[model samples]
Target: DAGVTQSPTHLIKTRGQQVTLRCSPKSGHDTVSWYQQALGQGPQFIFQYYEEEERQRGNFPDRFSGHQFPNYSSELNVNALLLGDSALYLCASSLVQGSNTGELFFGEGSRLTVL
Candidate 1:
């Protein structure tokens, strides 16, 4: 079974630029959630995608958006990135939505460094 995977394990972006990160969910999984983990902190939920639509979302602003494909893979798009956007963007996959007690398998993450 293939576990979650993310692209470009590291990234460098300047302020005001836009960036897109990718994620492939675990095998047999159907739900994907995006999170932003700042340095020295736990991840904060960005949004969740299931059935190719946004099933849920966190407190993130409009600048943060995402999309999930029929194959259960997903993408996170950050527009007009800010310095504060510098963080590890993690992608987590679950077998089902609300079936487990929020236990998630995370990818290594796409590290975005903003200047």
Candidate 2:
């Protein structure tokens, strides 16, 4: 029961730098989704990955992408980050279970601050 976990709990970097956040899904989950939450706002879905491919995506730009491994862990990569990118990078995992809509479980998140 590892639940969802993220690395670099707190990160600080200048604009234009790149950052990679990691996540491990809860036990027995096959799908992982990435979300971005800014101050005072709900998490927005960046993308959802299954079968090692992106199953769905939100309105985020190309700079935002992710990968899901066979073990159900995932990583989110953001390149040429901008000041606006400063936010809580949350990784939510859910068990597909053949459901039309899945439930999400969240991690503590990797906090990114851009200067």
Candidate 3:
């Protein structure tokens, strides 16, 4: 039973560049959520994906996009990256019941640096 796992672990990018981060949910989890955490701030919700569709989104700009595969894995794509995009990208897995998402299991996260 592996838990939520994210890839790239750490990466660096220049402004205007694009990056794609991947995530695999824990067993039996069907929903995946993406979050961004600044140096000292808590995680801010980016979006939620379920059944291969984006079910919810946060206040991020249109440059942020995502996709969920049928196998429950997900990918977060950030385009036209800015310095402000430097942060820890987190992947959380949960089970969606009706309109609510149950407790989330988070991965170690991918650290993105924009220079």
Q: What is the C-alpha lDDT of each candidate?
A: 0.92, 0.90, 0.98
Give the per-residue lDDT digits (tens) of candidate 1, residues 40-74: 99899999888898888899999999999888899
**How far in Å is the alpha carbon of 82 misplaced in model 3?**
0.3
lDDT of 2 by residue, 15-65 (tens): 899999999998888889999999999999899988899999999999998
* Backbone clashes (count) for model 3: 0
Off by over 4 Å in 3: none
- Clash count for candidate 2 is 0
Clashes of 1: 0
Query: How much lDDT does candidate 2 score?
Result: 0.90
lDDT of 3 by residue, 1-115 (tens): 9999999999999999999999999999999999999998999999999999999999999999999998999999999999999999999999998899999999999999999
- At residue 46, candidate 1 shows an lDDT of 96
Which stretches in model 2 have alpha-carbon errors above 4 Å? none
User: For every candidate structure, what is the RMSD over all alpha carbons to the true structure, in angstroms?
Assistant: 1.5, 1.1, 0.5
